[model samples]
Target: MNVQMADAEITVHTAASIDRIAPEIHGHFAEHLGRCIYGGIWHADSADGDGFREDTVSLLEDLELPVLRWPGGCFADDYHWEDGVGPQDERPRRRNLFWAQGPEELPEESNSFGSDEFLELCERIGTEPYLAANVGSGSPQEAANWVEYCNYDGDTELADRRRENGREDPYGVKYWGLGNENWGCGGQMSPEQYAREYRRYATYVGTQANLMFDHDLELIACGFEGHEWNRRFLEEINEAPWGAEFPLDHLTLHHYYGRGTNVAEADEDKYDRMLAEALEMERHIERMAGAINAVATTRDIGVIIDEWGTWHPEATADNGLEQEGTVFDALSAAAVLNIFNDNSDVVTMTNIAQTVNVLQCLVETDEDDAWARPTYRVFDLYAPHKGNEAVRTSVDTPTRDVVDGDSNDELPLVNASASVGDDGTYVTVTNLDCRSAQTVDVSLEGTDLNEDDIRGEILFAEQEPDYAVTKHNADEFTADDLAVPADGSSIEVELPPSTVAAISVE
Candidate 1:
């Protein structure tokens, strides 16, 4: 097949080879700051007695979420674990000064949703807990206490205190984050300073057995861009005078897509640029992971993109810290997931920027009404990729420039990835073009399958730049809007431009 381009003709290859695909990636992450905890996931007005919103829980259950991160973005740095524990009445509350504009308030520290509550929520949702500890403005002892509070089972002081507080059994959380965004919201520390603090915290926090029975507790040292922080962290751990091989299981990296007044006002060109930023996250993960692996070979440390998603300038408009998720956001999310699948070897775990109302949240709420955002739909579409091994697939297409007017830059037009599971093979293809649709032949080389055996489901909207959050049709969309593939396998189908199509082959 020949695709005519503005400047030249490009040949398309139908039978792309499957040889160099990466492993499948893991998903998890949520912060207590913003509505993520209060209005988002933990609604005090829940019809269910658990204080968790039934609608939210039901939506999460539908996605089959694998893991969840909690309690902090920048808020983790200033979070006092004691503030959120014990009795709600006895707990003191303080005004959140991190994201909030006004002065710090008091009597705001209710333990209604502290360690126990969070773990319970995770259990209800059927996902693993990824806890972030305080490093900035917090002492090493504080960090140690939290670990002990969650994992320790012996009759020690902390354990006894936990028992006195409420439950006697340990939560047994496996993943622990040292800090969040140390370069910015996490206290603006230098690479050397953060590395030293990471070593100090890792040395003190005791390890916990993995409750899920997969692997041991992983202590993730917070890492930054470039090789500076990675090198410093490895050096500190390797050359420690104590000679302790603290199990640094993962290093964290964060990236956000879209930087504009609002996602709605973001031009198609700018949206394309945001797609490039999402793609760049994979490169960042690759470079950072390589640096960490090179310095420490004995310990198996993977990369965790704990915080990532599209961040619009207008995100804080509705409630000062809330961001709207649109159809464009959904498309971008699909692109990001593809990148993660492509680099799953080193990029093991990722948490979308938030679970609820921060940025690119899966679901959004406003007092009485709750709706699944476009990004959430993308997650629903790609949920099957979770825990599945990734399969390699290649494409030959005419590449066109994705131009952004604001930045005056261009990115590639075609983006695609594939994953194979126990049931069948799944391929996700995206046409970055905003207007035109391109037809290409796809060949499955390794598997002996007929084209008629494949099934395809395409997610697209008639309107321009439709997103999950905004594309609400009161009559059409419902909780069931995000189910498995309804349409059986067909040989030819139109992949709507600027949309995601999930193709399943049995």
Candidate 2:
């Protein structure tokens, strides 16, 4: 059979494999900042006064979230865990130093949702918990004590404290982040300084006296998106000054797009610029992966993009409640997720920044109800690939461009990746052209999918909130909207401008 696409071409050879998409790669990040905790996940008036909304939990569960990174973005650096434990009413309230730090007694913070609350939320949602420990202003003993509280099941003071707090069972959290953005918001530390600091924290956390459980603790060092930062840090971590291994399992990198990050969207070029910038996400991964591999002592060092998304500046310049996620943001997110899928070999995990009521969030709550955003819909569609194998793909498309605040650049008209599991193969393609529909031809090398088996669904402005970027559509989209054509060797689908399509054959 022959294949030809009108605008672009995509070829999938299923026999060749990249790597299994890490379920942790489908993780979500929830910070203590803004209403994400107080008003977004925690419900004060709900029938169950345990701090979370059943509705919000159900929505996230539907998305099949694999992991939750908690209590941070930058909040991890300044947060003190001891203050947020024990009974809620008896817990001390302090000023939030990271999100909105001010002079005495401002930005009131109630230590209502502490480590236990976060662990409970993780258990209820059935996700692995990844806690970012404080390293900037925290003592090594403090970080180790936090780990002991969560993972130790023996008879120690902290363990007894955990039992007294009502949780007798150890949470057994395995993922621990050493710090966040140590290159910038974390402490403005140089790579060498942070590398030394990481050794100090990781060493004691592993050697903590009461840690009876014998489990492999995955300690991730803070890494930046740039190749230079990653390269320098990896080089520094290779040294064995204490005659011990780096204790590094992964490196954490953060990347955010849009006006404030790398590119700007405005007027007629809004969607186009945003999509082009979003396409740059893959380049960031490639460059950083190359850097990590170059200096890494072994190839086992994984990369975790713990924070990433499209952040709008004008909406956040005043630092108000997070801007409503829009259909435009959905396209950018799909593109970013596709990039992660393509780079599954190096990326062990990737978490979208601020899962609720903050930067490209999934859900927002008001005085009356919770509103599901377009980004949530994208996450739902990508769930099948959580633990699936990433089938290698080949994309051949025309280059196009739009001007942004930085410069005009050419990017692919169609960007994509493919994943295969027990159900079938899922081919996710995003057409970056915001002005016209683009034709994409996909070839599956080893699957026996017939023309009738090919199906797809699309999300775009017309099919979304339309002119209302921030509008909430509580009335769910009910239709399956799946249809595509297939020849003997290829499946073909047309994606509208600035749209994302989930094409599957089951």
Candidate 3:
């Protein structure tokens, strides 16, 4: 039997609601890299009549993912939209400049699953599509033309071409990202240089908002995690001659942790260190928000974490950036999600790295089968919080000191976030401790709760932190009934180490 060795207190401030949590906060990402596009989402051989793998599509559809960003991480920059359209056989084969793709690990793009296939997949899954345009090696005219091909409902060649390609009406893709990792893979441009390029691209892409189609597209500009770089970039973006007329809806950055800790070899100390690093997501959100408020005072640009999640050393380009999905990675996901909820007012949307067969993916697949990972369970447990109003939660939890080279850091053993909807108040809690269970006391302010009014569920209660999920054992990670003892306005639940729990009180 597991013995509880720690206690944590949580007080939900029901009245201090941040904002209606954007459903897009639960968005996902897919790139051309690895099996993510070809083998994971589509058949390994795109020439086959049924290109999409039904197993993968079913899993994604059930999750009800709000949005999916596509095309590339770095692949978007070098990609030419024209090469991906029309007949698959007639489409040009191109080299994937950044990463290898498909199950073969070849550094070439077959242009098999292109714009139409991707948008069709989104339609099948009932999820919004966010297309990132090429800005590195491609020109603004190309970016604008791609947008027209996908969104324009006119008599133009691009629009007619889209019809000829079988999509009679425009896909009406709403989220248009200008670039990806401009300071790195997208382009080796400096902050000022990228900002100028952003303006030039926006001149074509953003201006088409009223002229092109009925879809009022939201333009996303990629930013750097380095706070100073963001500050300088925003400063130059403010230099646009259009001034406040410069079109920008969201500023994005990528955050991937666990690069140092390999789950296969990590011990308890390494887990603590990784959790600490995950908690740093709060700092990134604050820093990005600060940069926006300080520099773009006149614009209401939201913050976006378009690319994020675990990128352990185990996941490299050689192997399609695939890593074993474990309970530890899922725990970190819950922590980062809580941070997103707390900052929902500014955090408009976030996409977890690769949706399938990639780093910290929610779903994993093989030739015969596909299954949900532990991280998928975490998203399932927290699904109720999506689109609900996120309220403030004060957590008083025990901490463990972790040794990080020259400095020491403390990792809280428990983390949580709460949201309120018409159904009731929902609370999610995570036990960050990997060694022992934690007894948690939750109090919903100004609300009376009885055992009959509450429904609770938990995940990974029977598993260890480093337990990697596989196809045969994936069902073991699903949420099970959690026994919560409630009295008056308080509830007490014992959370197993590295486990996640959710409570819905009516």
Against the reference, the lDDT scores of all candidates come to 0.66, 0.77, 0.91
Model 2 over residues 46-102: C-alpha lDDT tens digits?
223386777788878777789999888788898899988887878787777767421
- Expressed as tens digits, the lDDT of each residue in 330-365 for candidate 1 is 777787888887677777688887787677788777
The pairs that clash in candidate 2 are none
Which residue segments of model 1 deviate by more than 4 Å?
Answer: 1-26, 44-49, 101-111, 207-215, 402-410, 466-492
Separate clash counts for every candidate: 20, 0, 0
Off by over 4 Å in 3: 1-6, 243-245
lDDT of 3 by residue, 248-294 (tens): 89999999999998998999999999999989999999999999999
Best candidate, TM-score: 3
Point to the candidate with the largest lDDT. 3
| Rank order (by lDDT, best first) | 3, 2, 1
Q: Candidate 3: global Cα-lDDT? A: 0.91
- TM-score, per-candidate, Cα-based: 0.86, 0.92, 0.98
